[model samples]
Target: MTLHRTAILCLTLTAGAASAEQLADLHLNIVPRTDAEAARIASVIAPTTDFTQPEKFEDNSAGAATVRPRANADAFSQASGNMSFERELDFKLGNGLFKKLWVSSPSSTLASDGLGPLYNARSCQRCHLKDGRGHPPETADDSAVSLLIRVSVPAPTAAEIEGYFATMPDPTYGGQIQDFGIAGHPAEATVNVTYSEEAVALSDGEVAHLRTPTFTLTNPGYGAFRDDLMISPRIAPQMIGLGLLEAIPAADILANADPDDADGDGISGKAQIVMSAVYDQPMLGRFGLKAGKPSIWEQSAGAFAGDIGISTTLHPAGYGDCTEAQTACRTAPDGATEVHDNAEIGDDGLTLVTFYSQNLGVPARRDLNNTQVLRGKQVFYETGCIDCHTPKHVTHRLEDQPEQSFQLIWPYSDLLLHDMGPGLADKRPDGRADGQEWRTPPLWGIGLTQQVSGHSNFLHDGRARSLLEAVLWHGGEAAPHRQAVIDMPKPDRDALIRFLESL
Candidate 1:
């Protein structure tokens, strides 16, 4: 093998096989931090104690990449604030590709064909509407455009169980349920959900209703699912500050991990490790609801193939998630050609989309100085929410990704997997995330969910109708925090929500 290939192989093996402390440099293009620069970063990233007023640069959650808050639904659609005009063009091009609608193969559009014989959505934008969070179908008639059901089965053998990462796609239905299919092809399945509500009384007689969602797969195209099939419902999270999240050093994230609860903090965040499709190496999984994909590129590639049924270099299969059992679907014509690097969407296309996703600018915090917001901020911090939802991190100085490099970003996430208790469990093991574990999603642009997504649904399965409902669903490691909220004074609880909205 060539030296470059050997190096890559070694990196892949070492990162995947070794402990978190032994993690090698997965991002090779980064510039190492100087001692003085490192000291400054350490000082700035320290958790704040004084909550009398907003801390310095607290409004700029994405640091230099944060955009000014807009008073419309397009708030989440801006490019990185620090990006150059030349790079802005690339971001727009990526936005176009992101919203590009694909059709079935043998169509006139050469650049946009090869849609799934069986698929979920036509484009990335379909799921992540307006670059914001996606909600579950509101009514029975409403289609599940943004919500997708992931189906997997238990590994029959121990060999397939690699560390915490174990589970394979259902034998007949494949990885995810595809609700849409081109003509002459059968779609995988249709998803339906029924919810039963339970009212929980709070400290000051305020009752919060939590919905328990029971997802059902009706009208299965192939056949009955396996008895032991594990299903997980996922809603597309908002797209902002992803690049900043990716730039956070793996060691810093791993430092927060206490899988054994060694710190006695009741917050044992575990690092989700997965093989990177882009680097061909093991990387810290920071994206996806379960922290499955390592990098934005890999996540985008997987979405392109899995969600849209569009082939990319990373996932070259033309039929997308179609298994060999679906002979007709597998034999379907694809949009692959030599000009497009033998995949429907080539490297250039994928790179452009990744760039667009990476630079989705986070909006600056709102109402940082409001008395109630400040009180809520204190409540949030004092309630131990910061134990898992870490507030600040200094990103690596990168030679290439200038927009995300060396910036102190407030993603409000440690990007580590935490067991959120069985109340919020999906009962599906994805990569390093167990059934009850989920990555602490960043709260940067969460306050604007209703403004941008046209709804206020939160959580992995969109079961939480409000932020408080989402908070009440927290279990396991966050049970104490949840109880604290439940037992807090009504004014303090209201302030806490106000502070979260200011984010």
Candidate 2:
């Protein structure tokens, strides 16, 4: 009787709330053949302890049909949890483009040539290994395949904003310092980094040591850089749920913006707005360390141009990453623009690659019923951690974009900029983000960083080797939350970490 009653109730719920339909179908193993039927079944699906409870698993994790719990080192590499069960071939195609190695022009391989006159890594997978976060160099000789330094000199006059000078590209170095080049060309320069340890005594009589890195250049192959060179270090972040994040409507994102702390809360989360190169209209910047780029499409094209030195339709230059100062490099052969109608990676390539990027699945939450995680979840909210690391968002509806259509998600971020104080400041402005400000990075899949990326380093530069170190370094708006964590008993702190790991 109990089993029979529950089934009938679930059927009723599934037919009532279309928003919960994806999971209802998963739990019931019933596929509605027609759109109308599917919506009805999804609408009425009732909640259950094992499946339907809102907090039982992450909201996005609930609807993810392809959720992989057993796979690690590849956790962040899965297709969207809700990815149609039958569309794996498209996923594989995107994965191929993601891992394909680009080569220099004048090569026998027509499809793969046009790698670089100057570049960082040969392929996307070189940096975002296993589709996870990149780590800082452990040693000077370590190939910084995953790490790159962004160089700029102050813009004498603010490009658009008053009292704020935008970045000016170095006449010789350009926007970034590329350390690798084709065989005939010399590598740009050698980079060396050293860390100085700073210690902090917690209220619990425990101490945490923080490492700060200082970068130095040696054996300049290009030439001298600007005396006022503003250098910023950035490492590649994970590539899961990017489409979902991008799908989160700009209006929904702005609904969380509190730039003036207008609500009397100390946390001031400001949205970073930048004019889009692709659209020529101002759009919210959602990707990159500083939230510098607007759309996933542009971000991908920018990476193709900047990181691998492969020119695409957006960046049609044949001399990838080469400035006018480098004459031989610019004149060198280029396949993307020279041979491929002014674009090495044509529309097809970009579409396939972008499609693959958009579908990377977020792994399901583990141990959601665990007691420690539950306690930490509460502490996360009570101690004001939720103020900045916001949770819960119902994504927007996008017609014809089924992969990224209406769905509930929990990215644990406001996706807005916050002043992180001096400890984390790159002192470089991007669009509306100030030097000390950075977009609050989403915390989903952060727990699996070591499993996926082979490292647990965090923050924009990967300086925080552990999550706690990342927390302790917080200041400005997040200072109070940091203080709360430090003041908590070891058990509570452990519980908080447990909650984060469950994500």
Candidate 3:
């Protein structure tokens, strides 16, 4: 295995597996970025540094994959700068699978067939649009392709909580509320999202109008949903530096956890621990809005089965999440067969897609040194947003995984769950995350969302229209931080936003 060693970082040999626009368990490490010469990278590599006392200086290479700087509509598509030639070929193949549109079952195109009897989108790239985050529909008539609802009910104590996560999938409608079905089959329901705005006056008399969304299940093509069902909405997140996020050591993440707020910081970050079939034990959930998934592989496989209705080894059900209630839908012809061992998406296809997700480059910070951006960075720290959104992480040194190997990264997230308060709550629980708890999402490629996805709507449910709105909505553990920002002068507020834009 080939490894890239450097003065400030060590990139493990990127063998495979891994992302947003994230993967089935793309378990990858990251390399470091640097302006230093090749001789430095090839010889006299430094040992890993203590994350507790992390380096204060912002080096050019903010860890390998977490910091690639591309400023264009196609910014999110670039692979890591130091990717090996061999892996670049794999990245391209993975890109093909990532962008490959799946057709309905029993199609002539076998490699790309077996779309859902019920599904939200045809391809991964469609929802992730240019490998960036997705947004909510602008109007009720607009397509909800990128945004989907998760339906569930309070789970009885007798219900399984291990491998099969908590919450009961709607018996008739299934776990996900799919609005689009295959040619003849009717969709489960149409998602009608309406919002009522409330003005929040800041200390400076600046008002931030917050739009709270109400999702109504309209035009139920199937049977009526359970009377007591609960629904949660989610938008696809950007695909950048996922491998590096995955490589962060569990201890380092856990070290930052203050589940009980013992330090009097008011910021209690709880790690989302869920049952993992990949490691055959409980592991920290690192992907998804709630961090309900343990690895990118499981996350990708879940998306294949849930989002696209394409079954994989992880989710072998040929019915594509269709419950017994939907009998005909379950009985419909499937893409899986005796040859593929009842998997709609074969291992090879899953592998290719995972590889592509594992290596999506982290766009370099555009204006890290700018005056306003720097001030905003200081403001961000002062406001305590960095408490849950922890700034730096070093990827673990896994064997043959140098691309995301031991290197410093600045994803600006702790990957821990925090109570975001009632304003952003979905009133539905996922794993251990209550309705109001959400994983601190990474802020690496956010400033480029508009360049790639054409919209900047944010938060798990896409209610926050801008970064400021997103911050203003922070409550529970982050309420004090939000208040600090609200109390800032206009120039400071603008500087804070400018700093966020620099990410």
Residue-level lDDT tens digits of model 3 in 202-282: 766788899998888888877777788999999988987776777776655666777788888788787676656555445
lDDT of 2 at 450: 80
332-364: candidate 2 lDDT, tens digit per residue: 988754456567787667776777787888777
List per-prediction Cα lDDT, in the order shown: 0.86, 0.73, 0.75
Q: All candidates' TM-scores?
A: 0.96, 0.87, 0.87
Alpha-carbon deviation at 171 in model 1, angstroms: 1.8
lDDT: worst 10-residue window of model 3 = 15-24
Q: Cα lDDT for residue 237, model 1?
A: 92
**What's the lDDT for residue 115 in model 3?**
89
- For all the candidates, what are their Cα RMSDs to the real structure? 2.9, 9.7, 7.3
Candidate 2 structure, TM-score to reference? 0.87
On lDDT, the stronger of 1 and 2 is: 1
